[model samples]
Target: MAISQEISYRLERLILDGGLAPEQKIPSERQLAARLRVSRSVIREALHELQGRGVIETRHGKGSFVSTMVPGSGDLREQGPLMHLFEGHPRTLYDLLEVREQLEGQAACLAAQRATSLDRHRITKAFRALEETDPLSNARPDHGFHQAIVEASHNPILVHVLNSLKNMMLMTVQASVANLNPRAEMRKKIVLQHRQLYDAIISGRPASAQKLAMAHVRFVSKSMRDLELEGSTLIRVPVEQEAAVSHQNAQD
Candidate 1:
């Protein structure tokens, strides 16, 4: 990893692991640079990365401090519903959804074949907890439940891939809740999909489970794309996308 990244990781670890309390100020840039034996410029760069991720904040006149909203290890930052978007910055919503379908489908398949009794129980508990949560509670059981599946797969490589997907999942969930309807019917469908996947794993039917899991992931990705397009065409305009469209229109 680059020196800046290494410095960022170390600092993040310190804050996240409770070495630095929430709203606690960090050492000066010069002090940090001296301790890490890196240039102050490198420290600043690393700090900027952390700031973008909402791990820390800097006041204009005051020094930097740990963000009070530091997302947990399994937080939306790490494992939420839309965490997949940062991977190479997908060219389009369609491309992003397609990549998610492929990765999550594989995770479901591996989970089905390798899940233990404990994993089944944990997943079931997560699903039950989801039924009790609402958009207001801001509980992210879905991300954790999916991550549990990946962990049950007993594949280190798959875990790494899933890790890459975590941030996208989180961001996606937040976006969906912010804009999408997420009505009762949609909730039922999500619950059913999770149940089917879980049942296939518990029954020791890997192939069937894999098929269902992949189908479910594909369904979600497609839904997101449709919603994005719908929002673009029918409802509130997406400023980010609109800017691109405006530029294109101007050129044309």
Candidate 2:
């Protein structure tokens, strides 16, 4: 194979193998050349070829980014209308959690089965970040931990789809954390559940990881439902007390 063709293949493999995520910025040509031990001209030719094939895109001032047009990936903008609808409906948060229950569970299972050494390191880093984060303000780190698991699955389609739904997922997580954080018991349970899920993944127990991940989502869903129900329950006011307060307000 030609040198430039070989270079292009290597770059493509980096993207397909999850080394370079969709929409992530690729290293500059100089960086790529140095890393690949190739001449700048060859790096430029390979990048151009990849760009022609829609594997990457370059901006005028910014360097190339991995194209979101990877196999089985779609434009996130296509879901804009549906996402707006979801944002307007409180119940959609539950729907999002339901989706998470399935996707995250499967991702955990795959991660347990397939995680490389680097993937394990990334997952461990994300887990530790979550551990050190304040429970009351852990939405981002928690999301990062889950995202790392999904990426570790090494399924490009799964990674891209979940990344596309990033906004809705974060919204759901933020809601759950915000509502459950005020309850000390619930918060502690959540932290423990996360630890269990992380342990299962790291131990390479696919079944345990899947079960723990699904259960964690279910627990969050149930807790949020309970909190919503509690908020909606009406407290009875004495009729005479209400009447007296109304009468005094009229006089005032």
Candidate 3:
């Protein structure tokens, strides 16, 4: 396969398999090229193709993002467990975070009350791994650490809900790091809040853990809102793209 085609296929798999989720911003062309050991031009070609197919969207200052794929590219019927998704809505992505704040706070409270010795150990290990790292450098691990908290909660329903929304969670993580990493003070505050949340969960402080979880999610919500107000240059979306199967990515 041609280099650009190979990259395009690779990204397609990620989106289809949910490695990339709707509204999740992807790496910059330069960063993607670096990761794939290819030229920026190759990455650019793949991205434009992805864009044309309605599998992704690009904003001039914000970089590319995984959106809903083109019709016939995949099956996305809203049935069974995911019926609530319906047609999906990117503008309401923030609504998920608002729900996550409440749901995850309850998870933290459950973890604080019910976590066994091993669960506490795992939660601590996960949190510690994320504690000091630069948020911009590795968002996946940061995302994993938070997932660990839900696991520690020992509640199957909570775990299932969070797992179903994993892609969205990672998207939020990407957005958080993208916006906050450039601001030293805010980044530090985020890390500190994460640490405090971890401490509360592991130390068996249910109320504190719940409070911290709510606060942390609220901070993430505010950060995204702040970014929207910044008004970065926008990439012009081509009009002839394939019909998208789900929500459109929010563009400038």
Candidate 4:
């Protein structure tokens, strides 16, 4: 193979193997040449080839970034209508959680079975960040931890589908965290669940990882439902009290 072709092939493998995450900036030509002991011209040529194939994108003044395999927000407006629906009906958040239960459970199972050393390191880092974050403000970190697990699955299609649903997932996570944060007991249970899930993945227990992940999401779903029900009951109590008072005055 030509030197440029070989270089392009190696770079493509890096992206496909999850070494270069979607939208992550690639090393500059100079950096790549130095790291690979190649001439800058060759590196540039390879980058150009990858760009042609839509595997990498170059920003005018910035640098090259790995292109997302699936269309992102910039290239696709399909998620717009779905976002509107999620916002209009709060119940859709439960639907989103149900989807999460399946995808996340599978992701965890795969991660336990296939996570490389580097993948484990990233997952550990994300888990620590989540643990350190305040429960009330940990939505982003929580989502990041789950995303790391999904990426560790090393299933390109799974990673891409979850990435495409990034907005919806974060929305559900934010709602779940916000509602559960105020309840100290629920917060403690969630923290314990995360720890158990992380341990299962790190220990290479696929079955345990899948079970723990699904249970965690289900617990969140149940908590959200309970909160909603409590809120509705609280709302009804005031109305009922007003009705009873008015009725008594009429009877008097």
Best candidate per lDDT, number?
4
The regions of model 2 sitting more than 4 angstroms off are 1-79, 87-89, 169-174, 232-252
* TM-score, predicted candidate 4 vs. hidden true structure: 0.56
Q: Could you tell me how far off, in angstroms, the CA of residue 30 lies in candidate 1 after the best superposition?
A: 38
Task: Give me the runs in candidate 1 sitting further than 4 Å from their true place.
Answer: 1-93, 135-139, 168-173, 177-181, 232-252
Tens digit per residue, CA lDDT, model 4, 1-252:
889999999988888788889999988889999998989999999999998777899997799999987233254334455666654466776776688788889999999999999999999999999899986677778878988999999999998876655544453333567667667998899999999999999999999999999999899778877878877421111111123222110000
Please provide, for model 1 over 54-103, each residue's C-alpha lDDT reduced to its tens digit, 9 standing for 90 to 100.
88999877899999878575443344324344444434444555666676
- C-alpha local distance difference test of each model: 0.66, 0.77, 0.72, 0.78
lDDT tens per residue, model 2, 131-231: 89886677668778988999999999989877655544443333556567657897789889989999999999999999999998899878777877878
Superposed model 4: Cα runs more than 4 Å off:
1-84, 169-174, 232-252
Residue pairs clashing, model 3 = 60-235
Question: Model 2, 185: alpha-carbon shift in Å?
Answer: 0.4
lDDT of 3 at 182: 59
TM-score for all models, in order of appearance: 0.52, 0.57, 0.56, 0.56
Error of 2 at 243 (Å): 42
Alpha-carbon RMSD to native, per candidate: 15.1, 19.4, 18.6, 19.3
